[model samples]
Target chain A: MEVKGFWHWVRHTLRLFALYGKMDTLGLMRSMGMLLTMMLSDTVLNIAAVMGMLLLAERFGGIGNWSKYQVLFLLGYGGLVDGIINVFFGYNVAFISRRLGRGQFDHTLIQPQPIVVSLLTEGFNPAFGLPSLLPGTVLLGIALPHLVLPQIAGWWFLFAINMVASVAVVLAFQFAFGSLAFRAPRATEEISSSTMHLLMQLKSFPLDGLGAVLTGSLLTAVPVGGVAWLPCRALLGMGGGVTSYWLTPLLSMVLALVAVVTFWKGLQYYGRVGSQRYSNFGHRN
Target chain B: MAVMSAAGFMGDNALFLIDYLLRFLRVILFFALWRLILHGKGAINGYTLSTTLTYTLISEVFREVMECRTWLESGFWDGSVSMRYLRPMSVFAQYAAEWSGGVAFRLLTFSIPLLLLSSLMGVNPLPASPQAGILFLASLLLAVFVGLGIEYLFSGLAIAFRTHPWIFNRMRAAIGEILSGALLPFAFMPLGLGKIFSYLPFAGQASTPLSIYVGQADSPRLMALQLFWGVVLWLIAGRLWEKNKEKVVAYGG
Candidate 1:
């Protein structure tokens, strides 16, 4: 009587998990491990960057206005959020779409549950978990004591929001690539490859290094800057003297939700167009 | 009669081959021009757009000339070689000959177009010193062997696991891009990471050759280090191949 719709979705989501058996469970662990290793490498890479910053500090005292601790703090904050997104969303949907293009996707689709959940559940890369989470956790520990408790809590909230939004952006990008399967099967592979190459170039460095205009554009249009830079700035009190002081966890949540909505809408379009198309290896125009 | 016809054709139609080669060069030139314009002159990852454009062109040539016809795993996964069992030639010898033939064909065919493109674009040729040139040449050959060995190692997975392992291969490549300094120059990466990367086999394929050419190696000692890894990988690949040969699942066509 109270709420029928809410319970139904919860049941569907729970039922989705119930479909997995032993092999899928192993795949999931493998995916987790793989992701974890990659994240650990990333974190180690970030730590290496921190040392570079320390060297820069030795030479010039500081970069722009931020101290070495501030930079490391930002690096830690960004690394953690970045790891979470890659571990969860980086491989799941993107890898699924590629498999679908290769006809391996039929294996997951034939299952009795929701195809997406089965996909997400089945391809668990064990490396995925530690490679992402460890860097964030370690950096967070190192950076935590430097900030005020409330500020640290606020930063943590921002980190969660950033993770969600980044994952959504990646999902949207994947959906866009997935939609290509309807017209051109090879296009999905091409698009995903090119996008990964471009993404590494985009986010490997801080948005601040890109300067004001690009940073502003990133925050407003792409929202990558918002996910890491703007939130980090707000947490550390780096820039936007007036606006930075007021940037709250609530604002980050709102932006992240908006991005998710955009991504979901894109995914719906992919699902609608994709299921209707017929592609066999031998037949072509 | 076949040998006579081949000699006659080569003697009679050198101009036709040149004409076709010129047409192909023109098409590649136009495509590269379009890509360079669209990328915006902005530098990302220490490569100025111009340098990146040049790198892309060179890499394309290298990729075309050096990449094997099939990824090493293909022999295991696709059942392409069941026919080879019926053939008179040794399977290993057949593959090796084809690999060399394909690479040689690509290098011979692609060299002219690549040279013209580089000259037209005013991209400088890699280091001019005799010693450096010799070392660079050595590194490139070593890179090919190491790359081949890695390919075999990855391909061996298909024999053992009964899966294509393409995802693992891609992951390996991504890891290499970072650790091997193929995408971003190793020197530009954080120094601690660079030291760690210097020890990895992935860099021995792409970065070591490129670095030797670009004069990025610390000394001749570093060149020797790369050669050491190449040998190590070659040995490992041989072991992996021996192990995998027993498990080769030969399905009937």
Candidate 2:
């Protein structure tokens, strides 16, 4: 059944999480060890990425017209987006093609819940999800003081909106690409991962110096710039025009619309035909 | 895994396509970044635009070829590693063979195409000198062994700590990027810092070979250093494995 209303969705999601959140096959000591290690490694990885950019800015005064603080802000935004993706769709749940390819989408279909709600909550993982948040928050804490926003409240409001938009854009983009598993499940099962990797790798790159053609391609063709760079420029007051403020949110809405449509259509086809590869023996990996 | 099954081969093909495309875009982006930074200047720390581009191109291709992770982790984590004990070949020999097979596929499929794409983009793949070319190949061969040493070291750590492969793998790649000069060249760092990083064992992985290729560092001294690290790392990894052999936690009956 399709979940109705925002509160209803939240209720169902919470119930499912409360029931199944403790799905750690690794046991207690191992799980705790894994969490601590993940926290340490994630921090190191995040800091290293940001440090490289910061080092460049330090050496050269700044990257293009952006200051060191501004670059840090951009990376902070990227980390925040990554954290959101991880918390909401941690593990392989975001990689939906695995379900489609391995004929496991039927599990969601057989559930006593809407597929969307199932997906939204099934990957909820806050403990392990804490990895990216620490680094993102720390960097943002440092960068926020350096950025001079004339009106703190308005800037914060804009920051909050931009963050939501960035997360939506990333999730929708990944899902939209991932929905292709309905066609050639085996062939395109991993394509979504490639797309995710594309965004992850390119998101932190300073777009200021890449020139107009490449920058435009990134925005329209890949939407990689929206993950951090474009939103960052707006937040830092570097956006050259008013349209810049609306760009990411608008892109988010458009991409979300596309993703929803693509997902529903794929689901319909999946329900009717079923995955021929489906087997009694589970091999979802 | 690349050579194992039809599904695996197909997966590799898909990955290769996406990887190649990203490589194409990254070179362009990096070229633009350096160009903007240089801003009509001839060089920074004796790295002209040409040498820097060549250095990036070589490092990008070289790093991928040296990758060997999770091959050991997968077996160990699932308890299938014990199956290897029954085979005549030692676990190290089997893994070494497995890693080489994967590396060979990646070199042919991913690395060669990347270099060709770089060449098409006008990045000169030629070494700075004939002597440098010979030295680069030698250093690179040593790099393969050094990379193997690192994989085993980490594998030993995985067994000893009984740690999750997820964090261990991330930690390895993350540390490797900075220390091995994959993210930013050692020369690009502050003068003193660059010199310090260059002496570290990890620098033997990417920096030494690429540095020699780009003519920034063609000294046999660097190759000798790589040899020393390679020997040391392998020895330590072997010792660690022996000490932690019982720590292997194989789940499931």
Per-residue lDDT of B199 in model 1: 73
Clashes of each: 28, 0
Query: Model 1 scores what on Cα lDDT?
Result: 0.51
What does candidate 2's lDDT look like per residue over A63-134, in tens digits?
777787887788888988988887778655677766677677777778877777778777776766666687
Model 1 over residues A146-243: C-alpha lDDT tens digits? 66533344655555554555554544444544444433444343344444333323342345554476456555444445445566676666654545
Which residue pairs does candidate 2 place in steric collision? none
lDDT at position B17, candidate 1: 46
Report DockQ per prediction, comma-separated.
0.07, 0.43
- Please provide, for model 2 over B155-186, each residue's C-alpha lDDT reduced to its tens digit, 9 standing for 90 to 100: 78877888855457667877787778766777
